[model samples]
Target chain A: MSNPARAESIAQLERLVAALLAKGVVSEAELAAQQASTDRASPETGARMVARAWLDPEWRAMMLKNGTAAAEAMGVSMAGAPPLGVLEDTAKRHHVIVCTLCSCYPRAVLGYPPHWYKSFSYRSRVVREPRAVMAEWGSPVADDVELRVVDSTADYRWMVLPLRPAGTEGWTEDQLAALVTRDVLVGVALPKLPA
Target chain B: MNPRFSPGSRVLVKNDWPEERGPCHIRTPHYLRGRAGEVERVLGAFRNPEDLAFARPAETRVLYHVMFDQPGIFPADGKQPDKLLVEIFEHWLEAA
Candidate 1:
């Protein structure tokens, strides 16, 4: 059964869209095209980039230098989107991303953000107590590592380039990409070797 | 306009709370207001989002990547080796 409040919100949105369509402000084809583009986006695109970067030094350099160009080179359309910033995680430094003001994610690369990412609890707590928050998600950062919380509060959208897990040196690109889940790209979790 | 601050320059975020009628859109988070940090990079110029939100003719403003120590934002956290990075417009920042 659909929730009443959600159903009402959907109805309201539909009504608004219908009004816009009737006014010729937007066309059906345009809406369909937009939806198709959004549907084409997912975390797989980002995982592919990460897998390729891990295997190629030049690709990694380009990704670190310009994330938007890297994404476009990988066949992902970043037109009209804000510049994407790839935050590289290293041995001594770890990075986590948040948008305390709103849900400003790299939607073209990582798709829409998870529901929890948009919740008030996450937007408020992550910047304040990131370690405690990550621990709750079963990913803990050591005290020795410098944990940097990146706030995508303005124009630039951010995604994490997690350090490749050990023991996956000989793995194929497909295998390496499989290890990078959506949470890993967001920096809430790290990829690990299969148990 | 050219960027007013360069990378490695220490800057402070203004703590002003502008009052305006009707809908308002502010990109700077309240937690970062009044905090001091260093410019990590100059991210070029873009139209002022505050004006853009209202569909006004927005002026281009330089944006900066600012890095701050976590303990500086939260004093009770003690001297932890953690940091925070935020993208703040040049208008909201001043040389500290």
Candidate 2:
């Protein structure tokens, strides 16, 4: 059975869109084009960028310096999205991203955000107790290592360029890309060799 | 518009809330209000989200990357030595 509240919300949105369409505020074609663009992006795009960065030092430097340009170089369309900021994870420091206010993710590269990323608990708890939150994800940060929690509070969107794991030195980009997942890109988990 | 704050300079998030009452799109988080932090970078000018939310004629404002110590934000959390970076607009900041 359909949830009544959700159905009502959808109906309300449809009505609102219909009203806008009637007034020519937003055209149906424009909406379809936006959806198509959004559909074209996914975590694979980010994984490919990460894999390429791991293999090429210059590409890695560029990715660290300007994430949007790096993503564009990888053929990801940044079009109307906010500037992307790539946070590089090092041996002594780890970076995790959160939008304490809202789910402001790097949608141009990583596609849509997961449900957990928009949850109130994740938004509230992650900022106050990030180490604890990561531990819950089975990816605890070491006490000695510096943990930086990046809050995408305003215009900029962020993603983590996790350090490449060992034992994959001679791996091809495709093989390395397979190890990078959405959670890994978000810094909630680290990429590991297949068991 | 030029950026008011430079990288490495200290600034504080304004403790007061916007005069406008009721719900509004505010980028500055409540926890960061009144907190002191060092400017990490100048992110250039962007339209003020507060005005943009209402579809008003908005003016561009300089945004900044501010870094605050974890322990400083949460004093009771002890010496964790962690850091938190937030993207804050110029209007919400002042020289600390």
Candidate 3:
């Protein structure tokens, strides 16, 4: 309350809201008029990014080469995307992510990580044995697929750019986004598309 | 169950554990997180902001400063890309 910067932040918000009495900022009615918008990162964009890569080998190469730039080429803005580093899941190995210290995630690209990703159960064990974790999630992969682990720390945050699963011969990107759950991005679920 | 790491040891949190192996997690920031820091001149409770903010003087306990390589944590690959230090109970310590 005394710190100048923090005080300013709160003051500015108070001004924007006009006032805060017993109730807090109520945008329900106002938000409805303005057209409901997503608070979490847009999955539609992520699905498209994946779809484009799947359709174009060149783009796939670019994605592997430089994940951030590759994301931009697909029209997925990285503005405010966490210091995003992507882990590629190869046929021989799968990948999963956990933020043991805290819930540091690519909020801009993939949106908020599910609460479980931050829970001690996941943070503590995801690294100990990823295969078991994925199995619990219902999208277990072959033991052959190597399991790559990632830790999100102060400087970096990570997301899994899973290899495009076989199937969906002609599905649209919008449809694909529906299947791209946060769990998949975190490497818990390997996009269980209809193969 | 295998422990990711043991108490009181200086270790680097795997930046890309998913790309490699071992314990990993995004270090959240406080006064401390991921920095190559020291356990500080050991003694009694560490002073935390919450302790100061909430005025929980009675409940406050001694904590190590637990320095990190970098003074602070950021989003980039190397914003203060030094090392990390975190303070915890005695059991959290392992050989650095």
Candidate 4:
């Protein structure tokens, strides 16, 4: 941890955070709160909603229509965060979410985004060659299914409600929830039954 | 303020960047400029991030989630018919 390279990165991060604070872009308390909130919304929370939507048709409708309200109803406090949009995947359509500018994501429900999700390559490449990028991620879309790439360019963060895998009938919420991975929520991969 | 465009309105993103705003900071992506798309959702008026970046009082502008065709954006690379949705401010758009 005391290596020169590591020290340089640490210093860079410190400078960036300090600059943001000084510029009134974000406050210390707000940054701390966001960090704490990210800890609370793990993949489990995402799974919980996805599982609930899978079980209850009404909840699924609500989730697709307005994800911010759905997250609030599920007791996830997303105060000061932008509105959430849950893109439901169906037989005909698949959805993927990315932030071409800065990586704006549904951190309250899906936690922090992966490092790759914030990469410049991902931001530029995905928009141009979605199918190729998706295929590389191991989530190849079928020829018949239409792909929808959503860019988090403004004040709304987005997540994906992937299609429920087959053969999980009569499964408990916790069991089904476990299958809903963060990758699925980000649309980089899909949930699968146990092999 | 009443929004100029509603959901499903066909609009083209303004390609010009007003010189008065200067060139330091802008939220609208370069790839989306001049692209024709339909307003998928109307996000209410909010402080413009471009102005906010400079620590100035941001003038509120209506935002929209505009949906564009993949081919229209990346014609050569667009193998599959897909949709690309980007949020754009009302000022950066005009009825197509």
DockQ, per model, reads: 0.74, 0.75, 0.07, 0.76
Fnat, model by model in order, equals 0.77, 0.77, 0.08, 0.83
Candidate 2: residue pairs that collide: none
Higher-lDDT candidate of 1 and 3 = 1
Q: Is the docking of candidate 3 incorrect, acceptable, medium or high quality?
A: incorrect
Question: Rank by lDDT, descending?
Answer: 1, 2, 4, 3
lDDT, candidate 2, A1-195, per-residue tens: 122568788999999999999999999998898898898889999999999999999999999999989988988777787999999999988888998887899888999899899988888877778888888998888999788899998888999999999999899999999999999999888888899
Say which prediction, candidate 1 or candidate 3, comes out ahead on TM-score.
1
Worst lDDT window (10 residues) for model 3 chain A? A31-40
DockQ of 1: 0.74
Off by over 4 Å in 1: A1-8, A19-25, B19-23, B77-79
Task: Evaluate all candidate structures by whole-model CA lDDT and list the values in order.
Answer: 0.89, 0.89, 0.53, 0.86
The candidate, 2 or 4, that scores higher on lDDT is 2
lDDT of 3 by residue, B21-70 (tens): 54322223322322333453232333343334455563433333244433
- Tens-digit lDDT track for model 2 on B1-96? 788889999998999776457777899988899999999999879999999999999999999999999877866652387899899999999999
**Which of the numbered candidates is closest to the native, going by highest DockQ?**
4
lDDT of 3 by residue, A8-35 (tens): 8888977766653325655647545333
Residue-wise C-alpha lDDT for candidate 1, range A1-195, written one tens digit per residue = 222568788999999999999999999998898899888899999999999999999999999999999999988878888999899999988888988887899999999788888888888888888888888988898889889999988899999999999899899999999999999999988887788
Superposed Cα deviation of residue A98, candidate 4 (Å) = 0.7
lDDT of 2 at A164: 95
Provide TM-scores for the models.
0.93, 0.94, 0.53, 0.88
Q: What is the lDDT of residue A89 in candidate 2?
A: 92
